[model samples]
Target: MEGHCLCGAVRFSAPDAKDIGVCHCGFCRRWGGGPLLATHCGTSVSFTGAERITVYASSGWAERAFCSQCGTHLYYRLLATGEYFIPAGTFESNDMVMTSQIYVDRKPDYYAFANETPMLTEQQVVEQYGFPPEDAKS
Candidate 1:
């Protein structure tokens, strides 16, 4: 499926993706207004308007990308693997499914989902997804 930024300056394509993952980490919440709804697209994803994309090194292991033209939250990427988790909203599809959530312990009490999805806390996310080496700061 294909997705684009708010101003259409940054467009991406994620092939054969249907599952949406929620992330409630502090950085994700503060990045937007709530949990990040994204799809793991891996390196298989491709982007257009590369010049308009600004990537911020949000953490040691990951970077966040957005449109320089309209500041649309684009994706969270792993520095080591070039993997991407594109924003689900960008896909503009109603068929997406919420299969899992991460950084669940950091989720605020004001909001909750009824999806009954499997959740992983910060430690579990680190263990399962893996992170950059100690010296590999992004």
Candidate 2:
């Protein structure tokens, strides 16, 4: 799938992308105003207008990026593996299924999705992904 930032300042293509994973972590909510509906594009995403991308190191192990021009969220990337979780809304067209949601325990009760998808708590996400412990700071 191919897509670009709101102002067309950053364009990207995620080859063979499929599943859309929802992240309800606090950081994601504070960053995007709600849960992050993103696709795990791994390391196969290609980008254009890279110079217009601004990145923020949101955590010790991951960084989030956006278009410097429009402030559109571009991706949340894992530093060590170069895996990218690009926002689903960024895709021009997609038929990807919403398979799972992470950080479900942190999700506020004000909103909820109608989709019946598997959910994982913060601890489950960390353990499944083999992320460093919260106290590790990296």
The best candidate in terms of lDDT: 2
lDDT of all predictions: 0.87, 0.90
State in Å the error of residue 106, model 2. 0.3
Local error of candidate 2 at residue 107 (angstroms): 0.5
Superposed model 2: Cα runs more than 4 Å off: 132-138
Compared with the true structure, the alpha-carbon lDDT of candidate 1 equals: 0.87
Tell me the tens digit of each residue's lDDT in model 1 across 1-138. 988999998888888789999988888888898999999898998889999999899887889989999999999998889889998999866698999998898899999999999999888877877853223221
**Where is model 2 poorest over a 10-residue stretch in terms of lDDT?**
129-138
TM-score versus the correct structure, for each prediction: 0.91, 0.93
Candidate 2 lDDT, tens digit per residue, 6-78? 9998999987678999988888888999999999998999999999999999888999999999999999999
